[model samples]
Target chain A: MLNIVILGAGNVATHLFKAFETSESAKVIQVYNHRLESLSFFKNKTEVCNNINNLKDADLYLICLKDDVIEDYASQLKYKNTMIAHTSGSFPLLQNIEQSGVFYPLQSFSKFAELDYKNIPFCLESNTKSGIQLLKKLAKEVSKQVFEIDSKQRQTLHLAAVFVNNFSNHLYTIAEDICKKEDIPFDILKALILETANKIQTQSPKLAQTGPAVRQDFKTIDRHLSQISDEQIRRIYQLFTNSIIKKYE
Target chain B: MLNIVILGAGNVATHLFKAFETSESAKVIQVYNHRLESLSFFKNKTEVCNNINNLKDADLYLICLKDDVIEDYASQLKYKNTMIAHTSGSFPLLQNIEQSGVFYPLQSFSKFAELDYKNIPFCLESNTKSGIQLLKKLAKEVSKQVFEIDSKQRQTLHLAAVFVNNFSNHLYTIAEDICKKEDIPFDILKALILETANKIQTQSPKLAQTGPAVRQDFKTIDRHLSQISDEQIRRIYQLFTNSIIKKYE
Candidate 1:
């Protein structure tokens, strides 16, 4: 079994700790965080440490900290043979570390939310070939989907993720806001939202595309624009409509 | 059992026909369309006609035509006691028709796509109380979720649906485009897409929102913006970033 040491106690870190704990091939030996309060979740469950010097010698040191502190935290880690891998999408692979890699899971994680780990795509990158094999093995323990992605490809994936997850979710928030303003239950639109998301699983997004914008239904577009009073939202509606029209039309 | 005559053999009409076909309380006696070719699907199962003048007598005359032609199609229909309800998101209830109402299902429909009819929200509007009761009965037969929404409220719901379904799907398309250009397998992003969509089912969109924009991570945002070459997509990135930041920060 591969021994793992997790750094940080954020959403990704907590989820990873649980995932590793359940895997027969891998086990989380210790967890470290700067704030003693944040380490309470891992307390009594594993060897928790507040200082970087107290980190246990393990097969892999999975750094699940924020993007800003990853480099600093990794720089401070003094390891002999243990590979250091970060669970960040945008952050690059650490250069100074002797055995550095990336173990980015391309999924949003909330501490309380239940996840189907098998479906998550783990993007792995490493400075050495053996490091990648180790990362791949650990990733395969919890997930069926795994890819050996470089820093550039992973960064691109991160940007694309912003569009699919962040921007699309903001669109849902906009819909919720519109429903609230009109005294309409936001629940009514939930089915449609789920259906739209499900459609692309089987069909290509290009072929699955539908709406007044794609149809170039000026009448409906005019009506919708007239209804929106918010200047920013109206502009967003127009921008998205134009973007879709430019591509399809 | 209530007999219904469905006009227009499009996506909405076909889905509704199938939904009602399974219901013991309602039966579609006839389907009408301007083109004889479109009515081929409903030929053997039920009475079908190309000519609008040949519309059979039924308890409800459901006009499932395009928004622009709904009024003209309803005007040609000569009904005695049958209530007239048009299945549309944007089109309002027919003003001049004696027994007019809206039977709009606030869900996107494709003729070939399979749907979960029970989850679909059917929004009903009517001129007469009995017409509403009839619609409520028919709607409840196929779907558990039904609401008595007026034309104004239905219009608002339609607008919200566009934002959530249409706009969000467009964002997915954009992400797909981004992934394709970068030589990254688009399949990798699918898990993240499904997870983001699933989160809102239990959590509010506002609280479920995450990413650099919400986190105000300008360094990562700049890196993403620099990587994107498309002018419109970059602008969209900036616009959405600002919008999200404005809301959360």
Candidate 2:
């Protein structure tokens, strides 16, 4: 079995631990976090360490800590025999570590959310060929989709992810707000949302775009702006309208 | 049988004709368009008429024309005995038509695409109660999800749809652009996109929001913006970031 030590007790850590528990080739040797409260959940499942000094030897030390603390922890991390990897989209791999690599899973993690690894794309990179080869085995054991991506490419993936996931979700939030103000059930728009997403499956988003912005209907645009009472939403509407018009033009 | 005459040869017109062909009560007796070439597809399926004057008598005259031409067509339409309705999300019902209503299907329609009306939300509005009752039966025949929405609420739904469908699709377009630049397959983000939409089923979009912008991570925000070379997309990123920050605050 491939021994693993997971650092940090956030959403990613919790989900990783759960997935590792099911994998036949891997066992989490320990899970370490600075906070005792976060470490409590891992107590019965595996060895839980609150102090960084008590981290044990494992095949891989997967760091799932906050972005700010990742470099600090990695710089102070004292394991010489284990391969060190971080699960960050935007962070640079520590060159100071002897066998450093990245094992980034591209998906939003919620503490209580049920995660299915089949569809999630895992991006892996390592300084040494052996590190990448080992990481690949572990990745395939956990996920069906894996991509060999460097740090720069991984960073770009994260940025693009922010657009597709974060920004798109915010647009839904804005739609929900509009529905709330009009006392219309936001549920009505869910079908439209699914259809819009389904369109992207076979078509480029460029050709798939349709609205007043695409048709250049200024009258309808003005009418929509008039109904929007919130200043922020109105500005967002105008900005997107301008961009869309520019795109179609 | 409810004989129907459909005007226009666009995406919406084509889809409606197909759906109507499957309905037992409604049979498209005639498909009318000013352009003979646009009416070629309906030649064997139904009677195709190029001239408006040759329009056959039908129970309903469904005008699925362009928004700008909708009022013009309704005003000049000679079918006074029939219930004249236009499938427009934002256009007003033609007041001159004695029997007028709206048969707006709240979903994006594309040419050469399979459309299942089961999940599509049909927003219906009528000038008369009798008209609504008749339209409700027809709508139920076409789609399972039907809403009797007024002009104001219909307009609001259209606006919200702009955010969820149009704007969210644009965000996907932006992500595609980013991935294209990095030589990464846009397909990698599809699962994440689906997950984002699925989250709205059990949770509000506000509660589902995640990212550097949602977390107010200035370091990551700065990193993302610096990498985005395209001036317009960068501006969009900053604007959305500001909106998200204001939202969570």
Candidate 3:
């Protein structure tokens, strides 16, 4: 059995706390967050602490806080010998603490969305071999995918994730805005969005590329730009179109 | 059964022909293309002809040609009242032909990909009410989703589809490139990509948005931007990050 303490109450923290509670091999000994309201969700299930100084002794201290505060929290922690890990994608395995590791799950978490922990890939790294082994066992308890990624590779993965999730969703927002201005239902484009995301699963995204950009149809490209009056969006369209043309042509 | 003839054997034409063949109410009697190789897919399944002048009598003639050539194809067709319609999103309802309409299915179609016709939204419009009614019946035979969209709305939908499908896929390609360059397996981000796409189905794209940009985390954004060395991709990241911050914050 593994003893765990989650230090944060944000989306990732809450979701991880819920996931840990259900694991027969793991127990959430405590949950610590700065705000009392944030800690309310884990109050009944485990020992809740609003202060980091009051963090109880546990086998692992999983810091799910912001990147800026991670080093501060780890350095401030009074507990010794207990393994300290962060769930950050960009942050390195060790910063201010002597004993540190990473248990980064490469998936976006929302408070309302229910994620199956078994499906999410857990990217793990550590300052020591024993720390990594402990993280691997705990991660294997929840996720079938356990990757021993170094800090540099994890950082690259984080950057790539931003492009896939953030930039892709931004494109959807633009499409939604365009639909609203034209009094068109956005639901009509939902099938296209789903198909676009699903295509890359089996095929390479480079091969799956399509549209006026890939075809280099200048007339359609100009017409599409004319339709969008927003300068930012038009430039985005042009830039992406140029990139696609450069890639294929 | 409705007798349908498909002109032009491109990806769209091939997929639509296969879909219509599965329907008991619709029979695709002829497939026409300027190039003999393009019509080869429909050779054994239907009457394949390289000459448009050899077009046979049919209840509906679908000009599944490219947008630039749809007008020319419609004008050259020998049929007069056979309810001519083009399978184009941006193309208007009327062309040089007397009886023309739009049979735009707002979904990305690939020749090799298996598409569920029932889930795809079919947008229909015509010059006459009877023409639209005929299209609605034909569309209903295969698809559960049917929308009576006008020329302007279809144009807008096409533009939106560009953003959602074309632009979204471009971002995925970029991410794949980043992953390939970093020696990281692209499968790591597959779960995140699937989650981002699935979240927008139940929630608005606006609500589904997340990342350093959406959160307005400048430090993380700068860190991510630093990780990317490609000037074009860096600009893309910065531009998209700015857009997200502008939209949300």
Candidate 4:
């Protein structure tokens, strides 16, 4: 069985800990965090540590901290023979280390949100062949989809994720705001929102694109713009309309 | 069974035709389009007419034409003891007519795309009480969801729909473009996209929001912006980041 020490008690770390707790081939032997209060969730469940120097010896040290502190945190880990992996999409594969790899789960996570890690694509990268093999094995235990993505590709994926997940959700928020202004139920647009996301799963987003902007229906666009009172929202609307027109027309 | 004559053969028209075809309470008696080529799909299955004057008498006359021509087309149709309704999100309920109503389906329709009308909300509006009852009955035949939305509210829903569907799909296209440029398979982000959409079905978009912009991770945001070579995309990234920060911070 693989003994894994999960560092940081954030969304990714807590999720990873639970994912491995049920796995027969792997187990989270210890969880480390700088704040003792943050590690309260994993206290009774596993070995929790507040200090980085007090990390338990394990086969793999998984750093699931913030991107700003990942490299520094990884540097502080003192291990005799262990693979140190950081779960970050933007960060590159660590160099100048004996066993270093990246194990990034390509999905957004909230502390309270329930996630199905089975379908989540675990992007694995390693300097050594053994490190890659170990990550692949650990990833397969929790997920069905696994990919050998390099740092460059992973970074690109992260940007793309922001566009699809973050930007798209922001659009939904805008829609909700518009509905709230007119006393219209935002639930009406929920089905269309879900369908739009589902459509691109099979059809290309370029071909699946629809609306006044793609059709260049300036009349409707003008009408929509005139109704919006917010200057910021109007600017966003115009920018997106112009962008869509530039792409198609 | 209530007979219906559908005017204009477009995406909305085709989908509505297919939806009502299996409906037990409603049957499409004839489909009319100015262009004979466009009516080819409805040939042999139902009565097809090329001229508006040749439209057969029915209980309901449903106009499924372009937004620009819906008013003109509805004005041209001459019928007795029949209700008239147009399927448009942006267009207001037909006025100055004896029996006028709106049977707008609050979802984007593609001619070839398979659709499940069961959950699709049908926004209904009419001038008379009987007109509304008829529309509600016909709408309930194919869809489980039916709402008596006014012209003002329907217009607001249309604007909201543009944001959730069209604007969101454009974001997906941009993400695909970024992935293609980096030789990264866009399929890797599909699961994340679906999950983001599914997340909002229960949680509010504001609460569900994540990533650099929401977290105000300027360091990662700057890194992402520096990597992008496209000026328009960079501007969009910066604008969205600012918008998100404005909302969260």
Query: Which candidate should be chosen as best, given TM-score against the real structure?
Result: 1
Q: Going through the candidates in order, what fraction of the true interface contacts does each contain?
A: 0.88, 0.83, 0.86, 0.82
Model 4 TM-score (B-chain only): 0.97
Q: On residues A124-170, what C-alpha lDDT tens digit does candidate 4 reach at each position?
A: 99999999999999999999999999999899999989999999999
For B82-190, candidate 1 gives per-residue lDDT tens digits of: 6899999888888877788889888889888999999999999999999899999999999989998988888889988889888888888888889888799889988
Model 3 chain B worst lDDT run, 10 consecutive residues: B73-82
Error of 4 at A130 (Å): 1.1
Task: Name the runs in model 3 displaced over 4 angstroms.
Answer: none
Candidate 2 vs candidate 4: which has greater lDDT? 4
lDDT of 2 by residue, A1-249 (tens): 899999998899998888778899999999998888878889999999888888887889999988888888887774555689999998987787889999998988878878798778889999999999989998888889999998998899999999989999999999999898889999899888888888898889999999999989899899999999999889889989998999889
DockQ pick, better of 3 and 4: 3
Model 1 Cα shift for residue A104 (angstroms): 0.4
Task: Show where candidate 1 strays beyond 4 Å.
Answer: none
Flag clash pairs in model 1.
Answer: none
Docking class of 2: medium
Which of candidates 2 and 3 is the stronger one according to TM-score?
Answer: 3
lDDT of 3 by residue, B1-249 (tens): 899988988888988887787788899999888899877778898889988778898889999988888888887773556789999998777665567789998888888999998889999999888899989999998899899999888888888888888888888889999988978999988888888888898889998888888778888888888888888888889889888899986
RMSD of each: 1.0, 1.9, 1.6, 1.5
* lDDT score, candidate 1: 0.90
Best by lDDT: 1
- Chain A TM-score of candidate 2 vs. true chain A: 0.95
TM-score of each: 0.98, 0.95, 0.96, 0.97
